[model samples]
Target: MFRLAALFLALSPATAFACGQPVCLVDPDSLSLTKIITFEGERAGAGPGHNIDDVLPLQGATFGEHFAGQSVGARGPHDEVSGDAFAPLTMMAGRAGQNLSLVHFSGNTVLNGYGSAGFPKRDAQGEGAIAVLFDQDQSALAFDLRGGEDGAALVHFYRRDGSFIGPVPVQPTGEFAVAFLRSDGHADIAGFVLTNTDPQGLALDSLRFGKPPDMS
Candidate 1:
């Protein structure tokens, strides 16, 4: 009788042991923490030639030290605005100490499009590089990039502990493009450094933060 029972259990369907399974399948796309916003909801201004910088706090993100009392339309040479010249930027819904800063390069922190009245012009300033730092750990980040006339722009992401994540290349184009990055199963995206070969440098707009909509 014992031998007969053992043979019956061994021949049972695999579903009989489903409760003892050690692994469960998970969808990777469901685990993603990033999303891209093309700013389609917001107006792109009258036309490509018209640039607007007065718009702020769009989609919960702020530019430069504007929230910290910096005036809008402020322009300075790369040397003057680089480093700790401006206070770190913060998001409206971000944590108390969570902030973002621009380092080692100068250009308008807020510009709607490529060619505004006071937009920086292409110069012989050599290759320009900017470091964007986030004070708190984030799983995703994105921004609109434009005005690269010389060569492609490269962005390198880093972990919260300052470890390298990877590099993304942005081709020089006449129109604005979106560059988005996210960590895989890790919320360690601390910051990124962008270097551009364009003589006119690069302009960033419509900065986005937070997780993807589906993840919410």
Candidate 2:
């Protein structure tokens, strides 16, 4: 306990994720949420401006196997997805895997095997993409969105139990929440964020979740 406290103290106030900032949100149903982790280029040691569209099975990432508890998973061009530390959370195995639950896309999209430092700007490419995260069971759940400078980034949601949510709009910043899984069971989901109105539509940071109802 002392060592952990000391580590926290030793960390700079600017330390990513630990800065105690609230995550941005986009849920009209008022889904409860807490920021379980924050993306930091320094911790990942990959620094700022890393490639958000790298191919799956990325090598030498800072997030080894998982972040918080949910493993990192993203779908790429070849019907393949990779997770943190090169784990293939591919869709060929029924969009379910030992490390992943399901994958989705509104268009040809990919998930970031590891998190990055910034959100998208006004002219970024890559449209119609979303991310979903969870464990083998329904215990863990969540995903990410890249904020934009134009209008609110709205998305059409698909839930784990094959339900739908949204036309939800996430503001450029501050504690956004939406549901993809069952509200009471597993919040599994795949969402189709509309095509970027601006160039930098959805460049994202590490979308964090998992831990439990209290976000502990």
Best candidate, lDDT: 1
For candidate 1, give the lDDT.
0.38
TM-score versus the correct structure, for each prediction: 0.43, 0.36
Candidate 1: clashing residue pairs, number = 0
Enumerate clash totals for all models, in the order shown. 0, 18
C-alpha lDDT of residue 98 in model 2: 18
**Candidate 2 segments exceeding 4 Å error:** 1-37, 41-48, 52-122, 125-128, 136-147, 161-166, 171-195, 211-216
8: Cα error in model 1, Å = 44
How does candidate 1 fare on TM-score?
0.43
Model 2, backbone clash pairs (residues 3+ apart or across chains), number: 18
The runs of at least 3 residues in candidate 1 whose Cα sits more than 4 Å from the true structure, single-residue gaps closed, are: 1-127, 212-216
